[model samples]
Target: MPFLIVNTTVTFVALLSFRLLVKRMYALVSNSKQESYNVLIVGVNDDSIALAEALSTSKNQNFNLAGFISFRKDHQRIKILGKPIIKYGSKFYDRIAPMKITGIIIAGAQLSITQKNELVDKALANNLKIFSVPEITQWTDKEDVTSKIKEIQIEDLLERDAIHLDDSEISNYLKNRIVLITGGAGSIGSEIVRQVSSYQPECILILDQAESPLYDLELELKEKFPDVHYEVILGDVRCRERILNVFKNHDISVVFHAAAYKHVPMIEKNPKEAVAVNIMGTVNLADLSTQFNIDRFVMVSTDKAVNPTNVMGASKRAAEMYVQALQQNDNVSTKFITTRFGNVLGSNGSVIPYFKKQIENGGPVTVTHQDIIRYFMTIPEACQLVLQAGTMGNGGEIFVFDMGKPVRIMDLAERMIKLSGFQPYQDIDIKIIGLRPGEKLYEELLSDNSTTLPTHHKKIMIAKDKPLDYNIVCIHMEDISNAADSENDSFIVSKIKQLVPEFISKNSVFELLDKKINL
Candidate 1:
């Protein structure tokens, strides 16, 4: 009887307090001299209605309910809480202008960034502020919707619609399966780990040479997924013994090979290490995967590997050829898959972080060339596509991602400046530094003669390139490996040229090899 009475008392007190708070808020808004800005709520869903109620009762009294706008063609409701609900159309601005709508609040997260951007652009042109409510999953009982509202970010401007995936297909393949991710601490690799974890893998072995990043990743995965078993192995991919031990210890069914030296200029200077890691290291994993009879081996490739001009690009091309040839072996059981994409936004080595750092220092943001361009994908999006493609690959097929349109580096700098609330070349200067060694004006997803076949997924395609003999490719790789070990730069480049005839050097010492070959 006492427990029931206490519960009733608590419930009554909570309701009484809320009523008093609402009454006090109404009084505060009535007495305030500041004018309430007329606002239009986007969407007429439950989230929109809830947000409207919260805004109406908020103590800030900054927004006044003007009306609701519906994107749906069949939304028949004419009014919500006495405010007129209007359908969005070509005359959207014409309808809202009469009401003097000063702000627009996007109510739900169902709208794509492209759609939101269109709305945001129109609102900005008309001198109206724009805000978006957080997704339902992000909401908490203690926090109000108004508090979760925020201005759109630059990433929103670049985002595309979410990629569709066969969750059941992916889950079935991964459930209770032991998986291994090389370089699992890096940007792309870490995201792959996160995405794969959700599929309920039996165990995940994270192998990376970087101690700090590996430890951090371990801590994060442990905290985020306490139920999923994870083991962090701090070792280089070049160490065959260590990798073999990892494979021997765990019955890894799937392997994501993402470990490679990717920095163009740095790798150009140290081609020997690039050859050893990107080429020889990949060879190590492929050989072991085949020997161990692993089910799948997915290699993370790059757009640079297409008609490559840089040492890093050529090395990756050599690895791709080796892996492709491995599938031709009659004795091999593993299905080798390769995913090729361009620059990932906000990666540790990407220009986005470099520009951000330069901007934070209050000075010039350096661009390699005014005309240089590159395709970009978000880290998560790229990793998700990698998983999707990995599941869909048959064998010996290179999956090239459709990275939308190429973005000019100069325009990117300007966008970054504007997003930071600064005028380009006025408040922040974007200096054009000359291109570095081995750097190109643009990146290619496929070579001149290469063609792509469409897949079930719209965003991914299979690149059809002439197959090279496994034995011949292995012979060239062996020579390249020996040259790399001997630190013979000329021989290494020569062997790479033999393996990838399209490997032309640009603005570097290896350019002499191309001239000599022509002679």
Candidate 2:
């Protein structure tokens, strides 16, 4: 009886100590969280629950979970982790500051664009920063949960569902192959370099004229993809001797030809540079790829290439024709494919960043035309589609991506202002400037004679290309190249028009050339 009493006493003391320890831990957690910035989590679903659980732990260094924001009014009764979920409304907007909320974390992928816009406008008004969890595919278990919450980007707002990719096909084409990406320092080319590196290529040859951007890309690749081998060549695509040296030195199997003059207004002003770079640069690559017997040659073209109205567009179309015609040649063995896409969302000099800067300046935002609309895809999406197209093309095909509903420039400007915590026209005036030279109100993916046929990939389609005669295309391309050498803008543009009969100049001095042709 004495032994039993002694045992019970010891057990009781141990239980009491354990309970005290639990109390102490709770106190510490409470104290630390009090010192942290309080954050509200939007959309309390599976994703948000995971985020909340992570933030609840001591591992989250920056934020303390305050409450949840519910999209549905009925979700108010739902309590997650002993915290009440408040329905988002006008009342909630007023309570944001009072609640000590410093930030909002959007975790719902199903949230519509309209809801996102409303949330952004309200959050910015409250002087709160907005964050979002990255897509599930973007993170690994080893990655820190808090680090995955990134600032909500404008690309996230305009982008659609993540595109489906055929991993095996892309890997098969890119893996262990020596890849050459022309214009590798440009926005599109840089993204292509980043994406292709993930596929484990043999070595990536980054050829470009821009020294600073190329150096920056090298630093990024070393940090992000340390294992990927790359060579940065400071050379222009316009130089045949320089290009020939690159081809001779590297056993380049795959060519992603992204080198070209893209700005419509600038290209319209100097048609010589347009023809030299867009036409002859493409010609040099195409000829070299065929001569060296490269496996696949993929050229990145623009939607403006269809029924081109500017020197830039016309030149791109000319390049597209030359590439298509090469595939028709019985003597050529290389497969040349072209992928045409619309405006990349945040590329250099794109309207999104331009508007963002104007909004930051706190004044009038410029819109070329009130009715102008354009389809946009994120840079990564465009590059991903380019890779997918590269894998599927047999030869002589122009691939077009299905860019979802076009966005109006006027509406975009207003939404941007509101999202920046200001009222449009009241706080920031939107001035309508007339269309610049060679600018179009609408862009078309397919021409009158061409029709799209469905590919195995749902998002990509093959345009029934009417390939120009190989010999005839070569002769005209050579003539344009000669005119470019003479630095004759009118003569070069005339040759381009003759080469691409669909070419028509708009809002440009070259409109007079079109008139002359008609007369």
Q: What is the TM-score of each candidate against the true structure?
A: 0.84, 0.86
Off by over 4 Å in 1: 1-41, 54-105, 110-113, 122-131, 142-147, 488-490
- The models' CA-based lDDT, in order, is 0.87, 0.88
Instruction: Give the lowest summed-lDDT range of ten residues in model 2.
Output: 30-39
TM-score for candidate 2, please give it: 0.86
400-456, model 1: which lDDT tens digit per residue?
998987889898888776555566788899898899999999999999989999999
Candidate 2 clash figure, as a count: 0
